[model samples]
Target: MNPTDKNAITESVSCPAVFIAAPASGQGKTTITAALARLLRNQGKVVRVFKTGPDYLDPQVLAQASGQPVDQLDLWMAGETYCRRRLFEAARSADVILVEGAMGIFDGEPSSADLAARFGLPMLIVMDVKGMAQTAAALVSGIANFRDDVSVVGLLANACASARHRELIELALPKDVPLLAALPRDSSLALPERHLGLVQASEVQEDLELRFEAGAKALASEALAEALMRLPPVVFEAPFEDPFVELPSMAGITVGVARDPAFSFVYQANLDLLQQMGAELCYFSPIADSCLPECDALWLPGGYPELYASSLAGNRSMKAALLGFFAADKPILAECGGLLYCLETLTDYNDQTHEMLGLLPGEGAMRGRRGCQGMQTADLPEGPVRAHAHHRSISQGTPEPITHGRRQRHPAPGEPIYRARRLTASYLHLFFPNNPTAVARLFSPEPQLQTCDQSDSRSLSDAVE
Candidate 1:
């Protein structure tokens, strides 16, 4: 039976939704979305927030602002069915749903505009009009008229120099496209960013709260509030039963998850799916913790391991525990930074080398430019899985490749998945909802050995050295 069609219970719900987008990156989509969410929540409305693409950082800020867990909505990686299911579920309890777009409005293959058009949601384009006035309207007009399916309902002028600046831009905007709000140039309202993008919200919680409060105040004008309240309701039919209900259970399994500053790039939905499948998850820090929690399998997610390489390398007990875990032939799944942690050494962007777990025979070097990126699909024995690969570190070794990935933008080979014994290490971060069975089987108790011809399973000691 089709996974998305099994035991489907149909129901309809109304969710007033809008996609907060921008003309390009750094145009304040995330900031505006957070401000709007805060304003709506202040008005006593339950706001469900979502981020468009495969980002982990922006969602953190959105979640904090809405006081709710933010989910990602992507057309390719997350799939249309999954996106519909999430929208249906959010509509059940949320009075409004705000989706923060990725990059520019029409950036990638599955851009924010595509998502809005797919779901019949209007676009609230936020543009940074720092230098020009009438030219800003040309950009907004181009985005609004670029596609027939999607419509730009409103515009938010960000980083305006003065009241005169805001007035000029408002006058220049097309009559059809309304100017909802003009946020004055306030560096205090800007969120701190790092190489990967905005720094994680946890790192600067107090500062982020202040920025959100200021943003809300700037966006609390009567026009902005009225425009938000007047958004058309999104109506969709979906199965009443949780979509994850059909997934096969993994009873009696405990999955140890690495969760810390060094390994925090995990999707919340991934953990939720694990719980829904009956797997007990225990989180331990490799940077601060000395040992791994007892579990049947281990999952090391992607994060800023490069930034804390020395600390993770200094954690002798944690390194030993990881080596022992690999020796036991227990299942393990590592992505990006996790893959780096399993290597013998990690060279940061500054060219300093630090010892790593050495579970895999390789040394990962952080590069100034992105090593690999874009949507990736891996063909595994279990099944095909779709994910996104965004990293800046290159691993140097000849580990046997278990699955080869294909990139979406270019029809070229992508990241290679390395399998040694029960370990599945790769640069691609798998979206669990895409193929729950394949992911669950990765942690199944009864491990399946690879075919003799394709077998690259090596002894733990041999793999490390």
Candidate 2:
């Protein structure tokens, strides 16, 4: 596996491959994915990254690991045609493509297993072997047998205590399947964590190569490469033929987007979609830069802006930009983290209140314990908005006066999640297709974007700074 060999068929050809995953959620998928990308890069192989579900943070980390922007792979969330085209387009340029899984192998609607199967990408199964030995073999055997579309290429056992532990697991799998690598129990390899999942890659810029290099050295054993050689190659799907989304004429309109490490929760697709709609996206650091992007609309998506509340308070320029931007009465859309940033002040984990954009009339602070409440939805006076609560901090800012929506298909009460004056801010992010009118009406300058209609003239907000 000489990484530098340019003519290596599998190495040179942009063949698509996936990390088919999960024995469960708490497995070391994220850590291993990052390590693999770094290791492969060390081998001089070009790598591109993709995550299985509707994840925002991990893709950021993976983008850093792969040295290329990461994209999501869920068919429904990203649109099936979009995912197919992105996968192949990335593969055409990359030497090897790594798509990480979510939850256990078969968790979530359109599970990681389904994504791998749908794209015909080979799978690598990651099993956390913390408490078991020979039983680890039976664990993977059952998972491999559970799904027919998935092919377990190799098993990387995480948290194995010692070489003896690794040997014990290997001996158990000789007749069953190939055991690729065994990762030692090293807490240093684990990243920090809070109410949300693992702290994002942007939060920490330390020398990660130390841990990833060691993990790659340990995992890159002859047995692992041998296992990989045995797995049959995957046939890639052809490039999709969806008409390229037309780029809207940007004549001279600037779209202000909330940025900075504190407010970097926007999706690239949303930005791309806006660009196609004829607006130039401008970025302003909500944590550092004092001025907002001299653009029309402001998009504040979800992120952990509260985690760095003290610094956000110290930075006066961002606050001034936000206040001024809102004073101009341009259209504004805020999601979870952005919603918190739009508040009058954001109290950090330490209970100290820091001033924010002040677009909305409320103050929010951090809370604890009640984390990962699955999904949520809110039925406002306009229509039903869909979302989920994936934060550790709770706040008492503005309250919703309408119906609450649950994650399930059927409707329920008390699920309402967002409300603001001519604005909608919720922890739940809708697909836009679900409620395009509500989204468009929020941007309509008809003096009453607050009023939603089945056929309201959807127009861009006049960029205000």
Best by TM-score: 1
State the lDDT of candidate 1 residue by residue for 109-225, as single tens digits.
888888989888888899999899989888898888999998899888888788888788888888989888888888888888987888989888999899988888878863586
lDDT for 362 (candidate 2) = 77
Q: Count the backbone clashes (under 3 Å) in each candidate.
A: 0, 15
The TM-score of candidate 1 is: 0.92
TM-scores for all candidates? 0.92, 0.82
Which digits, one per residue and each the tens of the lDDT, describe model 2 over residues 290-402? 56666666777778788777777777877776666566777677777877776778887877788776766677777776654444444445444344456665556566533
For all candidates in order, the CA lDDT equals 0.83, 0.65
TM-score of 2: 0.82
Cα displacement (Å) at residue 300, model 2:
1.6
Instruction: Quote the positional error of residue 124 for candidate 2 in Å.
Output: 1.4
Error of 2 at 96 (Å): 0.9
Query: How many backbone overlaps does candidate 2 show?
Result: 15
